[model samples]
Target: MAYDPNNIFAKILRGEVPSKKVHEDEHTLAFHDINPLTPSHILVIPKGPYVSFDDFSEKASDAEIAAFTRAIGKVARDHGLAGDGYRILANIGENAHQEVPHLHVHIFGGKRLGRMLPKE
Candidate 1:
């Protein structure tokens, strides 16, 4: 899918929309989810206009990739979720129910998250 410049994440990055920002750097922006599923839920997004993980991995510069990866780790550690662990999830496509067109990762922690999916 094509990246939408008007996507909510893009708006957040552009400061057109307000977000409870957690971390901001030259390459990324991390913030608290407005409707969190876990006790500690944060969304980390790249500053660029990438539609999905595939898009990002294929097109982002090495510096951007490194910065984004480090940003995720930093956000997790800053939130104190590193010890007990956390789940990092990025829904890629329509089948995965990716709500937004921009690439973003969800950090779920602050509790035992249980299984990632239902039993078969």
Candidate 2:
């Protein structure tokens, strides 16, 4: 499938909805998740409107990918999670539990992350 304008993350990127933003660069945007999984949970999303990681190859440039990963690292370090350890996640497809059809990296820490994933 191709990129869709109706993607929820696109709306967030376009400022159609409100989000607790933590970081933003020319290529990426990091914001707090409304339904957080950890003590400090934020979503680092690309502004290029990618539907998922698979879409990254088509929708993002090499620089864009670098920017996205850099933003993720920054979020972890900036929030004082560098030493404590943090988790970065990107969900893809409906089977992967991607509620929003846009690419995003989940940054979560601030406390010990037990089991590293939610119970299915």
Candidate 3:
């Protein structure tokens, strides 16, 4: 399937839409998800738009990946999830329930999120 250029994440990346920013650098931006899955649910994304996880993993530089991982760690620690650990997720295509085309990392951890995800 073709990627949608007008996704909400694209707007957020363009600054046309507002987001609760948590961390940012030249290559990536981290922010709170408007519709959170948990108390500390956050989204970390690359500034450059990618159609899918495969595209991101294939084209992203080592530096960019490092920066993203570091940022995720920092955000988790800042949110007090270091001791308990947090879940970092990246949904792929529609089968994975990806609503936005842009590549994003979801950082979630707050209460005891059991082994399975919460019911929708």
Best by TM-score: 1
lDDT of each candidate versus the true structure: 0.95, 0.86, 0.85
Write out the backbone clash pairs for model 3.
none
**TM-score head-to-head 1 vs 2, winner:** 1
Score every model by TM-score: 0.98, 0.89, 0.88
**Alpha carbon lDDT at 40, candidate 2:** 92
Top candidate (lDDT): 1
Per-residue CA lDDT of model 2 for 67-90, tens digit only, reads 998999999999998998998888
Q: List runs of model 1 lying over 4 Å from the truth.
A: none
| Cα lDDT, model 1, residue 59 | 96
TM-score of 3: 0.88
Greater TM-score among 1 and 3 belongs to: 1
TM-score of 2: 0.89
Tens digits of lDDT, candidate 3, 2-38: 5666888888888899999988898889999899989
User: Model 2: which ten-residue window has the lowest total lDDT?
Assistant: 1-10
